[model samples]
Target chain A: MANEPDIQSDSLLTVEQAIANLQGADLGLRVYAAWWLGRFRVDAPEAISVLIAALEDEDDRTEVGGYPLRRNAARALGKLSDRRAVSALVQALGCSDFYVREAAAQSLEQLGDRSCIPVLIRLLNDQVPGTLPAPEPPQLAQPFDAILEALGGLGAVDAIPLIVPFLDHFIPRVQYAAARAMYQLTPSPQANHYGDRLVKALANDDLQLRRAVLADLGAIGYLPAAETIAQTLAENSLKLIALKGLLETQLQHTTPPNLSQGAIKVMTLMDELL
Target chain B: MTDSLVSLIRAVEDADSSNRLLEAVENLAAARLEGAIPTLISALSYNNPGAAVAAVDGLIHLGETAVPFLLEQLDAHNYTARAWAIRALAGIGDPRGLVTLLGVATADFALSVRRAAARGLGMMKWHWFPDNLLEIAQAEALEALLFVAQQDEEWVVRYSAVTGLESLGLAIVQAHPDWRSQIQSQFEQIALNDDSWAVRARVWMAQQRLQTESIVQPRLEEQPSPLSETDWQMIIEKLYDRKGQERLVFAEGDPRRYRELVVAIAQNPKPV
Candidate 1:
């Protein structure tokens, strides 16, 4: 149980009780209430204003508490899906807390606001060389994946050039993120050369890397990937996602042929296996 | 990425020595790489407790994505790997893990594996999926858990089975209100006749929880409740120390002695 707590269902409070606890004296209670409010997804106008106000909260006890109040607040705002939260979330991109900034970027994506694209693009390579001075046992605020994912989720096509370089980064996770972001920024399978690059990565010997690229190809609805994804369905672990992706690609094909046939075969296999 | 982190991931996948592989598993876990899930699933066969634990923790961190890979590992030739996979799948509590969990809970040769399966089988609460799947999985899981609770040879396994039943019972009561009286009778039967004081206490507690309000907080943290990690760990340590090679003599004897001991423990202020 290194760090993953065996979470039990919390004794939940009502909306009014939880909203009241948002300003409670105990930081844990406040954070718990913030999460509960989000989990419950209450749409009270008063709740939205309070959650928005909580975005500016300065509690920096992440080392002590697993989640910061502001991060939970940002996440709650996103769950609300209220467009009124767009400007505050955009400004939250500049929050000193890395997680708070990440949460805001993710919420902006969920809110489906294109206005925050330029603001989020700045966080694509935000990891610095050293730790902060104030937060003891300092940690760098790496917003790299959140930013890439947000850019992808927002369909920021102009950010493709910015995302492509990270595909060769020494970190495998960075490469994975870059591949996913590349797929997201590419408007269509025919729009960019990244599709070919991803297809090549699908044949890469690394299982994790191959799976990552396969998921991206699926997400982009790359029709040429139908054959490869269909073959991968032979591995049961990859079957569910592979079938999902192949079906997505199949729907994109206007003229049914070998690609559509392959998808049909895979779907039959899924029906038998899943 | 740190050079050590990348090296550890590589070593976990390709190391020639068990020691090297185990060390690599520990390092990868320390780095907390969610991408190292496949490596962790592979490391389960090493038969090193520390490495198995690290792998389990890593899989737990990966959460939902780790479910299918974990389910695949149930077919591993190594029983050790299968055991760890059952534990990890149980820890994740995903509905996808239910079928394998039931298979292992009822038929695994190893007591530890069966115990893990029994405990895990009860943890299945399929709220995320369609009601049809949820109803099917939950009913099958309950059937498997009930089998282990009533018939497992080892007292420890039976104890875990009861806890599993309790967990499934609580989930059913909370969500499936229709399953209340039937599950309550099952708990009361175990409470009245279970051989072990610990198992009986667990059943009584379940009965009490069911008999009481829907939202009653646990009265004691030290008690061997299914949800408390620390208490479960203690129960496991205590059970393993006694070594259940022979059946409990008191299991078939007077119920009053076991009942009194359970009451004293529950009512006492001191920690167990």
Candidate 2:
């Protein structure tokens, strides 16, 4: 029985069963189990321990499609958001597989641990400095965006200089990510004071640029920009996002001042139009 | 800062071995080094599929920077070089390449080149550009894709054209509303009548996707667990036994190997 594969309803396995399956010989079972444990997120020490342990399981020697078990484990650990998995996730950053490294970085972001800052910064720096402007391919894993977003989530102030250059990157995704990360790292209401590249980007003719900047301003809760964003509602190209930013600003604002009131008016108007 | 990349560019030029040339192209593209565009364009002509794929990826990575260089290669004396250049440009999806792709998709001598062009026509990534031109370009692109889908000789080319047809409509059908009929007619025609099984199958999937678009709320982000608190607790106890080392074996015919179970595990039930 010990050697007989524990093949529970592959998706419905109990956390204990899934953890045990993580140690199983069949590669697919291990991958499935790791994913299940993460989905369960039972908040058990044993579940996290097994996921971290699975990170070192390179035993699946099949070359086709690469070994996905470890990658799945890393992703599961991220979903679990256990601080205990931080060191393991950080180590997985250097894994040879792009998916594994991506999974590790994304998990670190989800974990929201500031301790992962140095590693995230290092990974961001390692990316090819400049690439042409393009949307991130739907299926491609974007390590640069993952790293920058992690740094921003962690609020690494020192990473601002590193994140700044990417603001002008030709890749629209990278440019948008750089703006968002900078917004996260900079103190709110003071984003414009810190060179506010997103604000600077608002001057560009690119509608995507305006939309991304508006989203970031709203996300960062930069209340001062609410009025400016509201002004764009007259332009059909920018109206929907302009309204979204105003709504976000209104909701996230702690202060009930003219800015908040104006946001309310704009949001109500947008709602009525809708 | 680009010193190492400069050395790689020289290596690509001077390398005696094909393997070295390919490696140099990979390094240049990975690093996204300056002056790697011409080298990547030249490497596309190589017989090696690995190197050719890498070159295409490299040129695409270079984005608009490689557009002019790629366009220039259409006039190259070598036909193989011209074909590869079309593929690279197609992969890049620049609006500048649209006319060239249309021309090649219809008249290119090589069937491979025409197929590549057809595939490129489908992959225009129109949203990447400024919005003012989107409506015009989308209309033009759809017309061209339909032309290829209806008239292309090779089943492979038509298959690719069908994909383009689907892509051109998927996004705007909901918002424009008027596009719904045209998209339905095109996709339904191919889904029911396309001769090749592969083409018919792809068209069928596209048709289904279009039919369901309005009913299904497109999922933008991962959601929480849909399993009830009781169900979650039940699954938890059964799976969370830390002391147990042996794995649970699902019977061979277990019904849990389906998407519904995953949805139950992964998605949160909405509040009534």
Summarize candidate 1's per-residue lDDT along A60-170 as a digit string, tens digits. 367633338888999999999788999999887776667777788778988999999887776665633231222432343556666777788788989888888877976
For model 1, the stretches where C-alpha displacement exceeds 4 angstroms are A1-8, A11-14, A39-46, A59-67, A125-142, A187-274, B1-272
Q: Give candidates' CA RMSD values in order.
A: 17.5, 23.0
Tens digits of per-residue lDDT, candidate 2, A1-274, equal 0122233444466777877887878877888888888766766888888889888887864454334778888999988867999999888886656677778887998898888888777777774332222233553434676677678767789989999898877676677677778777776566666325555655555545666666656555554564556543222223434545545455445331123455545544432221
Record all residue pairs in model 1 with backbone atoms less than 3 Å apart, i.e. clashing.
B195-B251
lDDT leader: 1
Model 2 regions more than 4 Å off: A1-274, B128-132, B174-176, B212-272
Q: After superposition, how far is residue A46 of candidate 2 from its true place, in Å?
A: 78
Q: What fraction of the reference interface contacts is present in each model, in order?
A: 0.00, 0.00
